[model samples]
Structures are given as structure tokens and as C-alpha cells.
Target: MPRDPLSRLQWLVFALVSAVFTTVYIPQPVLPVLRQTFGVGEGTASLTVSAVVLGIALANLPFGALADRMAIRPILLTGGLVVAAAGVVSALAPTLPLLVGARFVQGLFVPALTTCLAAYLAKVMPAERLNVVMGSYVSATVVGGLSGRLLGGFVFPPGHWRWAFLVAAALLLAATLAAYVGLPVEDHEKARQAEGVRFRDVLFRHDLFRIYCVSAGGFFVFSSVFNYMPFYLHGAPFHWSTRAVTLLYLSYIVGVVAGPLAGRLSNRIGNGAAMVVGSLVFGAGLAVTLIPQGWAMALALALVCAGFFTIHASAAGALNRKLSTGRGRANAFYTLFYYLGGTAGITLSGHAYHLAGWHGVVALAAGVLLVPLSTGLVEMRLAQRDGSATRSSVARAR
Candidate 1:
């Protein structure tokens, strides 16, 4: 890999990741159209979305473990193309079940690309810069998700919704090619052997276990907020029109900026410090929703988006940095826990909203934030203690 190509590779990976995320969420905005077209009920139509989620949740760890022993660039390239192919098939499927299966296949392969890219980026980037770079990656994902949703609106009015999938696949294919051309090949093979690999190697660390928990916990709250807030906006004093409620998703634009900001802050102050700050920001956002005004709530949503991405970007860097080996597996675990938390958060928070309404949802989200904040403080202190001990050892040697 030449220096210039390598320099561009990070951005290429970011684009590749963004494309993957866009493909994953394309079905979300068009679910109603799918139901009408396929003549299926709501649950059956929604199976297209659920099937993909199920595939990613189940495949993260195994694909991550596989990345360690194999060539990541090829895996990423293959995954990207496979997802595109899935999109084409999904677009043309005659039956709902087949479309759901195609979406499932799309989910199955995407984790390969994401998990491997995280480990590969950790390997190649300067340690000090990795946090910011990872943040940029997270930001790309936000842009991708937002673009896919917006695409549904843009294409569904005149063109059929399937055009959205087709167009997204075309763009994703281009991204995959750029990544394939720009991504460097690994050359460390002659010396190192893969014979001693074991599952315990990646799963047994207490520090990592805590970080994984933090990853899952953070996403749980974030996802809960995003998934359920629409219900609140549609009801009550605000009583926003459906189109106005949809416009509220524009707040997610904050996430596109949040990732890089989180990265730079983490670079200056350390991942723990940045993450704690982000937690406070997010907690504040959640609290601000207590205000009765709609404009205030909108600002609150922006803060929450920024704060969550900031913390999430930091967590990714922390997970990658904690492991000298088995980085892939650690990332896999982090992603696995992340979605698990999201699943649990949406379900539990829905129940909370059901029983107690908006206030109950807020209370549950706030309570959940405390655990990660405490963990961040502990992690920061441990790093400081380690730094001081290293300095003392150096002084004694002198």
C-alpha cells in the first residue's frame, strides 16, 4: 500500500461502512408500501426488518473471530458486494418471505465488514488518532442511515420504493469498489501462526467485559429514545402532525457531527474523560425533555444525539485499544452487546411508556445512564493509576 492510497483508505472504509448501514435500514421507511404491495399484515411486512436484525445479532461474534484468521480486505469486499446483491434480490422478490430471506442474508454478511474494519483500523492507525478516526466511522454510519430513510421519501413518491433499494445498491457497489482498490493487504503471515486460537482468548477479560457492557448499555438508551420518541410526539400537548413528526428525525443530523467531535475530544482528554462528558451531555438532554415547550424538546433531542454518538465513538476506540490480540473478537462482542441492549431497551421502554407514559420512559433512560457513568469514572481512574505506576517504575530505574 502506497502512502497516498493508505491515507485515503480510512475514508474509503468509512464510506464502505456507511453504505452497509444504509442498506441495512432501507426497509424501515418503506414498510407500509411493502405491506400493501405484498398484501401482508403489519407483522408479516415487518418481518423484512426483523429478519435482518436477527441475522446480524447472531453472526457478529463468529464473523469477527473469522476475520482474525483470514484476510479482512477480501471479506469486506465480499460482504459489500453480497449486501448489494441482496438488495437487488430483495427488490425483485415475488413473495414477502423471499424478500425477508434476502434481507436476512444482507444482515448476515455486513457484520463481517464492520467488525473487520474496526480491527483493521485499530491495527493501522496511530494509537492517538484511532479514537477520532473511529468517530468519523461512526459519523459515516449516521449519514448512511439518514440517507436511506430520506431516500425512501425521495424515490417512493414518483418511483416505486424498490427504486430506493436499487439506487442504494448501486451506490454501495461503488463504495465497495473504492474500498477494494484503496484498502491495504495484510503482510504479516510468514511469522505468525493461527493454531492456538481459542474462544476464551477474547471473552475472558474483566476490563473488556465491562467495556462491552458499557457499549450495550449506551446503545440501549440511545435506541430506546429513537424508537419510542415518535409515539410521544404523535400524542399529547404537542400533538404534532405526522409529517411534522417525521421532520423531527432531522435531529439525527446532529449525529453526523457528533462522532468527529467525540473523537477529537477523546484524543485530547482520553476516551474515559470524553465518554463521561458525553454521558453528562446525554443525561442533560434527557432531563431537558421535562420542559413543556416543543422547541426545547427539539434542542434536547439534538443534545441527546450528539452526546450518544460521542460516547459511542469513545466506546469503540476503548474496545479496540484494550486488546493487544483478538481485537476482532472484542469488537464482535461489543457490537453483539450493543444490539442486544437496543432490543431490550426498546421492549422495556415500550412497557414503561405503556404503564407510565413519557415520564416513565425518561426515568428509565436516566436510571440506566448511571451505570455507564460509574464505569467510565472507574476506567479513567484505573488508567491514571497505571500511568503513575509506569512513571514511578521509570524513575526507580533511573
Candidate 2:
């Protein structure tokens, strides 16, 4: 329990975030099943998945504002409890409407912790080691999303999606309890020394705004592609079953390694260069999905996973680096756009899937990747300019 950068508190936050994010996608892999079980249409069944994202988009800024004032630990504990309660309500839902309602409530509170984590670390951790901890946290999100998805579609017995909710609730409860017990006690005096960040200052940098908007576009493509992937696999030449389709999410395993690798790469090169590499790789993977074969699709997904995480980790690092002050509000605004992209992706692309088929969705994702790639190129130039300036300054000093 020393005040080292990689303390037990960091790991506790990592674990807690993973558990909280599981709720984000518990119903994702099982959307088709929910359709049949509840006798709802494709769009209606999808509401079970999209509702939570919408809630997260709606709540991130408001809850982010809340995190600026309150201590993060107590807020996290309360949010976890609320999430656990919502899970129980979801498990007991006799109808889809009730289940969607429960998920919305869960989404509303979970950001209470997710939004605060980066800012809290910025306050407490030494600057040099922040990327390692943040990378671990991003990796945890991949694990949680994959875990909840697999739990819904494969781990639980058929017709027992409720068990998935129960297990998720248990994990949430455990993460909350452990965080409360094990996390380092905050230095209230140190915390009080700095009042909350002014979001206006965080936004004053035009470069930061470009990065944030580009991030939203990147996540938008990522969300739409993943949201409708099962449907594509379930149709035509492949005709995969639910379990088979759910197993594809395991490809997200690549993200576990990609997060840290991307972070380290950004640490060496620049965040913008890392982002460009990521976008190129991600676009390549997305393009590969045009192939109609199963193994090819799987390989494509793996590439997609790796590329997406690379962009995600690097972008987050760049954002945090820029927000030397007001880390809380800065991160909150970042997540605000992030989840908003997710909400928009699911809503708009669901219509594309209905009218134009999976290829249309792919086409859209490919087009959207341009926003990030363009911004990433601009960032690379900026980083190069800054580095040259630093070198010249050093030479002059000598």
C-alpha cells in the first residue's frame, strides 16, 4: 500500500471498471434470442441493447459534473450498488420493456465510476506512469464486454439469460465491495487543495476539440459494425448459430494485448502516429469483412479488434496529456462524445441493416473511419512540429 503509481488502488479501479462495463453489453450477443423469447421485432429487441448506451450517453456529462464535486470512491460504491439492483430488476423482468428500463437505470449510474477513474488517477498518480494504469483499465473494458457477451450467449444455459444478469450483478457487487475495502484512502487535504476543473479551459484548445470529435467518429464506426455483426453471421452462406456468433467476440481477446502495446508505442512515438497506424489497420480489417467466408471473417474481426484498441488507447493518452488541468471534466467530455457515438451508431445503422444488409453497414463504417484517419494525420504533423521546437530550444540552451 505504498503510494507508488501502480498500487493496489489502481488495480482495484481496473477491476471495478471491468465489472461495471460488463453491463454495457450483457444483452448484445443475445439480441436475437431476446427477440424470439420476448416476441419482439428486430428493432424492439435491439432496444434492449441500445437503451443502455443511450442512457450512458445521456448521463456521462451530468454524472461527470457530479464526479467533479464528490469523492470518487463513495460515488463508485453507490453506483455499483445501483447497478447491482438494476441487474436484479432485469433478471426478474416479465417483459422486455421492464428489462430495457432496468438497463437504462444501470447505464445512468455506472458512469459515476467510469467517468471519475482517469481524473482520480491524474490527481494521485505520478504523470509518467499514468499510461500503464490507463492501458490496463482499457484492457479491462474489453474483458468485461467480452465476458458479459459470452455469458449471455454461451456460458449460461439456453433460455436462461437471467443467469447472465445474476452473475454480472455478483461481479459488480464484488468489485464495489473490494474497491471500498482495498482502495487507498484519499488525502482529503490534497484533494481540497485543487477545486474542480473548469470544462471551458479544457475545450479552449482547438486541437483537443478535433481529437474529441474524431474519437467519437472512430467509436461510431466501431459500435455500428459490432452491433450488427451477429445478424450478418446468422444469415446466408455462413448461417451461424447464436453460440457460434457469440464465440466471435472472443476475438476481442486481441484487444487485451493491443491496449498496452498501443500505449507503449504512443509513449515512444507520438499519440498521433499511433492513431494513424491504428486507423489504417482498422480500416483494413473492416474491409476484409467483405469476404463471405467464415474463417476470413474471423481473421478480419481479429484485425478490427487490434486496430480499434490501438486507436482507443492512444487517443485517450493524448487527451489526458492535453488536459494537464481539469482532468475530470476533460475525461467526462471525452466519454460524453464516446457514448454518444455508440448511441448514434446503433440507432442509425440498425436502419441501414434493415434496408441495405451487412455490406451497407460495412460500407458506412469504412466511410466513417476517414474522420479519425484525417485527424490522426493532422496530429502527427503537430507532434512533429512540437518535437522540432523542443529540440531547437534545447540546442539554444546549450
Candidate 3:
């Protein structure tokens, strides 16, 4: 018999991965509510987000390594179950400290879902279709993120903050079950080989190192905006409602298009070119937030999401191509730095917001985008020199 089509399996895994990842971020739009409910300050409530990011950053390496040793399905299922349990614990926590702790635990499990899912997809999908499928996965993640923020904000107004966690838990549980049932079982040897390559061997490759740096920088820029924008809107003249603020995430819909489009565009121009142009677009979008108006702010956020997703999809695809071994570990390392940037950049931006208000936050974000833009420039020049050498070799061969 012909093999079963993997498309359905791909979508199921994507949804499960997205929902699990979204659980970590559900508290972001509700930070103000968390502060009021827990009798804490904004910075402390913000810890609810930063702590989870720290956990993800810390756990990425170990989980990626584990995916190399163990079965992908089991790792993903275990992580999903742990995340669901953490959501329940978060919902029931009697104190802010307890809640933050639960969130940290939830974060710990998330990397298994993220890193393993990517490796699993890479193993199962044809190389030609990898970018398209990965783009869909990225889009699903954005949708989950938007849903979490919107649901959390909406549920809190009626004194139902617990419901938000409960709902997230339910979604995660469903995802876990679907994944357990639907994902095909690969041979353990294949899984190990896919993940088994030594991290040191992978790191020795120059191209992979360049891709990792660019990927890290792209995520750094993306996280800076997502982490800070809600806080900025909640302050100043706008003072948007939880619902209205949650609606800001609707802009992520642009990412649904930008990601796949960027992948296709990368094929034409090159991943480095896509990264450079995308960073420029992202910077331009961040600058637009300085415009005063609810609509203008919304448009700026949409542009940021679109641009960020474009660069993110292309960079990640490029990184996967460059890695010769320990793909899972390499992905984990990429995410480690990615969430590290999120944790450090957002926490620092809190201070910037404290010092300079929204303008300060915008300036800080715009400045951080420079890191990735510069990396992209360096990558382009390197690609050019290599291309020239190849052409010279071809002329001599002729």
C-alpha cells in the first residue's frame, strides 16, 4: 500500500505545538490583571512572562539533546502533558510566587514541544516541501499566540482569570491526545540518528554558525516588540482595554501571509537578502508605533508581525539547510539564544519604559533591530565573496 499522506499529520502536530507554546504567553496581555489580582507591581507581574521565557531559554539545550536520544512523539506528549498540568497549577496557585513558579515549570516543558516538533517535521517531510510546511507551522503559532492573549484579556474582566488557564489547559490536553493518536511512530534508530549528531560537530561548521547568529538576532528583534507593546499601550494617552489591547494581536494575521511569501521570496533573492529586507521592514514598522492613534498603532503592530515572521521563517529555513548534523541540538541552540534575547531584551525594555516612556521603548526596540540588520549585511558580503570565488573556479574549469 502507498504510504499515508503526511499533510494531516503535519497539521495536527502544528496545532499541538502551537497550543503548547501559546500557554506560556497567555498571561502577557493580562499582566495588569495579574498585578491587580495578586497585589503586585507591574514589574513583578511582568515576571510572569519573563520567568517562563527564562525557563524556555534554560531548558532548550537539554530537551533538544533528549530528542536526539529518545522518541520524538513521546517527548512531545510528555511535554504537552506537563504543560497542561502546569496550567492547572497556575490556575489554582494561591500566591503570585506560586503562579510564577508554575509558569517556570510550564516553560521548562515547552522546549520539548518546540525543538522536537521541528525535528520531527524535518524527518518526515520532503526537503522541497519543508519551507512551506514550516511556514504553516509558524502561522499556526501566531494564531495560537493571538488567541491566548485575546482569551486571557476577555476572561479577566469578569473576574474569571482562572478560566483563562483552565481553557488553555483544555486546549493543551486535546492537542496532546491528538498528537499521541495521530503522529506516526518512527523507528528509534532513525530518531536517534536524526538527533544523534554531536553538537560540537555541528558547531564546527562556519555556515551553521552564521545561520545561528542571524536566527538569534531575528528572534531578539521579534521578542522585543511582542513583550513590550502591550505595556506601552496600557500606558500613556491610549490606555487601551484588555479586549482592545488583545485585538492588537489580530495584526499577526499578516504573518499568516508574510511567512510563506518570504519563503518563496527567499528562493528568488536569497535568505540573506530576505533577512536584510525583512529587518528593514521590521524597523520601519517599529518606527510607525510613534504615530499617535489607535488605528495607526494597530497598523504598525501588523507591519511588525508581518516583517518579523518573514525574516523568522526564512532565517530558520536557512539554518536548517546549513546544519549537517545534530539538527535538533542546533535548533535548540537557536531557540536558547532566541528566548534568551526575549528574556533579556524585554526585561531591559521595562527599565527603558520606566525611564523614557513609550518613546524610550520605541527607540530601544528600533536600536535592537540594528543587531540583526548588521548581521544580515555581513552574511550578504560573505555570500558575495563565496559566489565570486565559485565563478572564478568555473571560468578556470572551462
Clash counts per candidate, in order, are: 0, 0, 0
Per-residue lDDT of candidate 3, residues 315-362 (tens digit): 777787676656667777777777887887768777887788777767
Report the C-alpha lDDT of model 1 over 307-378, residue by residue, as the tens digit. 888888888778778877666566677788887777677667767877888888899999988867877788
Q: After superposition, how far is residue 51 of candidate 3 from its true place, in Å?
A: 1.6
The candidate 3 region of ten consecutive residues with least summed lDDT is: 1-10
Question: What is residue 127's positional error in candidate 1, in angstroms?
Answer: 7.9
lDDT of 1: 0.76
Which residue runs does candidate 2 get wrong by more than 4 Å?
1-7, 124-132, 189-197, 387-398
lDDT of each: 0.76, 0.82, 0.78
lDDT agreement of model 2 with the native:
0.82
Q: What is the TM-score of each candidate against the true structure?
A: 0.80, 0.91, 0.92
Candidate 1 Cα errors over 4 Å, as ranges: 1-3, 27-50, 92-100, 119-136, 153-160, 181-197, 236-243, 267-270, 290-292, 353-357, 381-398
The TM-score that candidate 3 achieves is 0.92
Sort the candidates on TM-score, descending order.
3, 2, 1
Error of 1 at 311 (Å): 1.7
- The local lDDT score (0 to 100) that residue 88 gets in candidate 1 is 95
